[model samples]
Target: MRPTDIDDPQYFHRVVDCQWACPAHTPVPEYIRLIAQGRYDDAYMLNWESNVFPGILGRTCDRPCEPACRRSRLPEDKPVAICRLKRVAADYRGDISGRLPQIPAAKNGSKRIALLGAGPASLTVARDLAPLGYHCTLIEKDPRGGGLMRTNIPSFRLPEKVLNEEVDYILRMGLETRFGEEVTSLKAVLDEGFDAVFVGTGAPRGKDLDLPGRREADANIHIG
Candidate 1:
């Protein structure tokens, strides 16, 4: 047998099942240990490094890590409350405004990026690029950012304040915003001479079922 290449990063990730299962591959144990030690700020920052919106994700994420937790293998043992623990860190953490990335006064290059829709994906892109000194413009039909998050998600499930706080963090990074305007033509946008354009407009419609009695039950049957 090949003596198990421990040096490969995937090997370590596999050894930690929960981390491996996480899409972000966040150092799960490290943050958990920080939480255990009552280092809420450190724990929150650790989570933020991998997942941009720790507080929002902690509340809404369909935690894949829990199912893959090693403790679940034990008899009568439940998986750790990783999701709730993340929320706890967010709830208890101190002010982190100074910890966020600092954007340069002048743009790094002549590259101007046009991001359509102020959804999570576009916001994340703006967050990453803005700090690196790329000129990012966010155009949204809505009066504000958050896209479907504000339009679709119930306020109870995801409090408006919590969503606003995280989204504001990215917006404050000196990115340009053109709200309440929807783009009708891609060619028109291209004509404006943007170095690149990113489209992140989320799906607003639900797929309909083509089964029998589809027309009869249309009023009562909701696709989503």
Candidate 2:
């Protein structure tokens, strides 16, 4: 998307329409304006504050902002490539190894919690829990964390380096992670010193389709 894609259109028009499109309600036109001024670092930071996964979003987001582009219906039938532009901005300056926000010191001593999975939900829960003064220990069976993100998602979609880097940033927030040990049973984890045990182990078992009512001969076919 060109600078004109946002700035040339009246500022009010760009802001009002684009804001409505973003699910996270990120300041779309503001970041685009910053990019137009070559303040790429600020633009990237702004996007990251609202959505931590800027680079991931850049690569995989289903962009709704493009259709909202006022440039549409003009001489060119094409709308501004908002997704590509966001990716460009992020690609240039989304590095946060040394610049990530520091976790605050713990207030009243809180009990420790053990997290049984290191997937997104578990990781996000820990991230939200850590700053609140709850010490969290994340356990994963794989060599590295990121359950489905590391295993199921193809490398072409999410590069290992990018995923690792982002996960590292979150880990730097003072979470303790142990890899290669599966939580075979809840009995041991709770028996240990853990104050609370959270089992985020995901989708271990698929629903059975061989039941009597679910049989193909009995009724309509259902794919689960």
Candidate 3:
């Protein structure tokens, strides 16, 4: 029998149309409450637990939660600014390494997993599994590790410092990263003795626009 996709259990909660409509089902109100009490570190870590990168998503996300924010449904009401509050927590938090989960050494007979790409997906996998004693290796085709964040995204929207710091946090887990490496065959990596391999090449490309009057005439038309 063939398998099919299933919606994430958290998707239902996200559809509840509250101010906390995050991809990871973060408890937006809880963290905001923490921040209100001056528990910046706790708020930051709370976001980190679910969304992983509060600062990055706080900066770059399209703000899915805003549209669903219940406050705005009221007459002459505005949302609680959920996205910006995440940034505030990140901005004022103390050192987070102390709260990070304990990571085991590389030689613990742990499984050696190879991530096929170095985008956010691969990095997040590395982040989650590294602490669980998996020796993660990232294979990226770019000169650096941040993939689209380092390449396509403008640094102004998500600053280089923020991206670099977060990526470095994942790297500090002692995972190996090979830059400018393209893996055409998963068999080759398996043959070389990787116990498992996961590929996360980001979203699919957008369809080309072939309209008659507005196709490729202008040099300033961008299609990201």
How well does each candidate superpose onto the true structure, as a TM-score?
0.89, 0.69, 0.84
lDDT of each: 0.90, 0.75, 0.82
Candidate that beats the other on lDDT, 2 or 3, i.e. the better one: 3
| Model 3's TM-score against the true structure | 0.84
Over 4 Å off in model 2, which ranges? 1-17, 73-75, 186-224
Residues 16-76 of candidate 3 have per-residue lDDT tens digits of 5553356677778789899999999999999988887888888887788878888898999
Off by over 4 Å in 1: 1-9, 203-205, 209-214, 217-224
What is the per-residue lDDT of model 1 for residues 14-93, given as tens digits with 9 covering 90 to 100?
59888888898887899999999999989998998788888888889999999999899999999999999999998899
Question: Once model 1 is optimally superposed onto the true structure by TM-score, how far is the C-alpha of residue 153 displaced, in angstroms?
Answer: 1.5
TM-score of candidate 1 versus the correct structure, residues matched by position: 0.89
Clashes of each: 0, 0, 0
- Candidate 3: stretches off by over 4 Å: 1-16, 106-108, 207-224
**Model 1 pairs in collision:** none
Candidate with top TM-score is 1
> Between which residue pairs do clashes occur in model 2?
none
Write down the lDDT that model 3 would get. Answer: 0.82
What is the RMSD of candidate 3? 6.2
